[model samples]
Target: MKKFFKLVGFASFIGILYYGFITYPKLDLISGFSAKSIASGHFIDHRSMEMIEKGDNDIKMIDLATNTIDENGQFATASVYGLKERKAIYREGLGATLIDADFDISAPYEVPKRTKLVSDKLFPYGNQEAKDTVFSSVDYAKLNAAVSNAFDSTDKKDKRTRSVIVIHKDRIIAEKYDTGFDKDSKILGWSMTKSITATIFGILEKQGKYDIYKPAPIVEWQKDKRKNITTNDLLHMNSGLEWEENYSTICDATKMLFQAENMGRVQLEKPSVFEPNTHWNYSSGTTNLLSYILRNQFKTHQEYLDFWYSALIDKIGMKSMVVETDMAGNFVGSSYSWATTRDWSKFGLLYLHKGNWNGEQLFDAGWAEYVAGPTKGSKGDYGAHFWLNAGGKFPDVPRDMFYCSGFQGQMVAIIPSMDLVIVRMGLKENPEFDFNGFLRGVIGSLKR
Candidate 1:
């Protein structure tokens, strides 16, 4: 009996060693190589994208450029890259990836190095006054204390935070990044892309595009009752589309991220879950369909990027922005937008000021009000693509606070009553969010 037990133990030890030392090293090698491509400004292959969608490395791609691989294994200048999203964040390297990748890559065109701090102008919305507020600085010590307390109280071990920035009255009041990362890191925004997508649609409405009162511009709806679905319903997550947002490997959401070539199109093909505009089901499908509509409306990716950037991101001077691409090259509107911490703050401030920054009306005056209005799910408080602060009567924070939150922990909380914008970025899974606690603490710590 003793000899049998000894043999079993020996075998188990060997197995563990093999997986830890050999298997993990190989996995890291692949991840490392993918990281190299990002650093070198090379577009990562689909296989790499699959790895990221599975949350294998925590590192995800924000941009897919046109590139050709040759016999010598080098990327040339024929490829032109377009900025896609507003704030991009990386998953792995635990903040180590950005710096490491930066050191290795060589590009022909002057690629705007991803940094923690970025500034750019948005179209028709651009103004000198807005630029000033977008670049404002904050009190770091007090802000750090708040974030540190929030993190320490959490139980998750790998709770990595890449960046955090706070904005007040359109000025960046505080900005910070984890070790091994600076303002240039293009971290993935995950579902936060939904809010950004909503912004684009808002701009489209301003441009005389389809009105929210009318049926959505989806082609599939014209033949069926889905035609009753309105753009307003989609924006409020009330499209009644059938979709399971489960992140399981085979679930529709994960599959869209990992396996589907045209994520937006795939969602459009799915049937409805409930009556249009009646119920609120948090479906990525609505955002995906929005992408399809944008693609159908616009001529090309560059045109879409140009229109939005000139009108929105560029106006606010947000740099580190890069939107992800689907297999069809359309911006993945559901998930995947990347940017630095500071750049994200710019977005938060833009919305906080009711689409007006530095004396310029970037978005329709009603845009912020629409986003801050609640939806059917929240008993009429969560409106459009943003989340409002409910269950009021909290300290330091006002009852009317709202925010644009993304997967992991990318957040842009806007406290309208307090004239404050709080941005937090990190990795935190659902059914276990520590953000509310953090928000409470931050409000508690604010200088009274």
Candidate 2:
């Protein structure tokens, strides 16, 4: 009788441990990431599960979840041990968003129609091929070797540098992709989406449609001390909002992204921990709040969505660009955006030329200056929505170089002094691939 009671008690303890601590948190985390990542990979990027699964499931513990695609329904489902299943549905213009049981389909949304390119001229202007040209100052042999070094996999993460594009003086000096991937393949920009969102605000400010120095226009903050937070503060990621960015557990970041309906409201509801501009902490919630502010700028829903494409995306020829949204129909501007490598290069070039595409100025040099300018309390390693080298984060890189960086080694590095823009996209981050060393090699291989 004593042995039976002990065995029963031990069994109950094991059940609670498995379901509560491990299974539940993982289900919450991987469900959203798996559903959304798989849906976008299959539907937007047009990748097979074999290709997507290799990268998506490579993460630690994330390998436990199983993903299924619903081609007819245009959605994907993810489950762990067949418990608490989560689904992400793909929408025509909005991209993929995770849906809860109460997810509303009746809500009306106005998405922008992409204008087809009719011209055949070369890129940065049209969809035609660029004529090959060789610059005398470039060391072709050394440059090729440098780009090749990114693929020399010494470890598992090292095997994942799927794409690399180097542009010097408005020309494609070198570009390469791993097997099963190509120039046309669309990869998720991850947090690189933040810089894109900030760039939109820069364009609006250039046209006198918005202001960054004023208090953030969130209505919820208007009645309290949080009202003092400005758009610039949000961009600089120093809003001091109480947030937990942990993803390994069911913290604020995972809960808001996977469980919450309105992503924007999650940050707005949090209490302020420090006065605006007094602290610097990176927050995905800050960028989503920035996206929310963008939504309220216009009177109608269509205008807000249209402006992102008409004014910036399509105008510059990023035809592959698509910014995904959350259940509340707000651009998941913090983390979800996908585009081809060549298209992403154009975004860096816009800033490289100080926002002038061909002959037309999209934003201005002032916006670039503001973006590259280091934010206070960031120790010179950060700027408004962009990461900076002013603190010499990349010692071999120039002080003026600022770049858009994302999770797992995704980068769009621009060095105006070097007339260089290097885009590197991969399934792994840091230590696995030495960013500083790669930059040193590429930069050293070229001379003006």
Model 1: per-residue Cα lDDT over 1-448, one tens digit each: 9999999999999999975564332332233333433422323222233333333244433123322233243322112232111111232211112122223333221112232323354321332323433222333565668776544234444556656766665555556676545666666676778888888877776677747778887777799888888888888988887878864224567556544657787768878778976788777767877877777776765566455556666666665566655545566677767676766777888887777767877678787888888888766446787777664423335668877778777788888766788887776643355666667666654554
Candidate maximizing TM-score: 2
Each candidate's number of clashing pairs is 40, 1
Best by lDDT: 2
Worst window of 10 by summed lDDT in candidate 2: 151-160
Candidate 1 overall Cα lDDT vs. reference?
0.60
Cand. 2 Cα-lDDT: 0.87
User: Which runs of model 1 end up more than 4 angstroms from their true locations?
Assistant: 1-144, 150-158, 379-381, 391-397, 429-433
**Distance (Å) between predicted and true CA of 211, model 2?**
1.1
Question: Could you report the Cα RMSD, in angstroms, for every candidate shown?
Answer: 9.6, 2.6
For residues 1-448, write the lDDT of model 2, one tens digit per residue.
9999999999999999876776675676686678778898999988887667788567775676788998999999888778778889999888989999998766776677787555787875788878886998899888888888887455445548889999988889989987778989998998999999999998999899898999988888889899999998999989988988876667887787788788888888999999888989888888888888999998987788888888888888999999998888888889988999998999999999999988888887899999999888999989999999999988889999999998888999999999999999997777677889888888888985
**Clashes, model 2:** 1
Off by over 4 Å in 2: 1-20, 106-108, 152-159
TM-score, every prediction: 0.70, 0.94
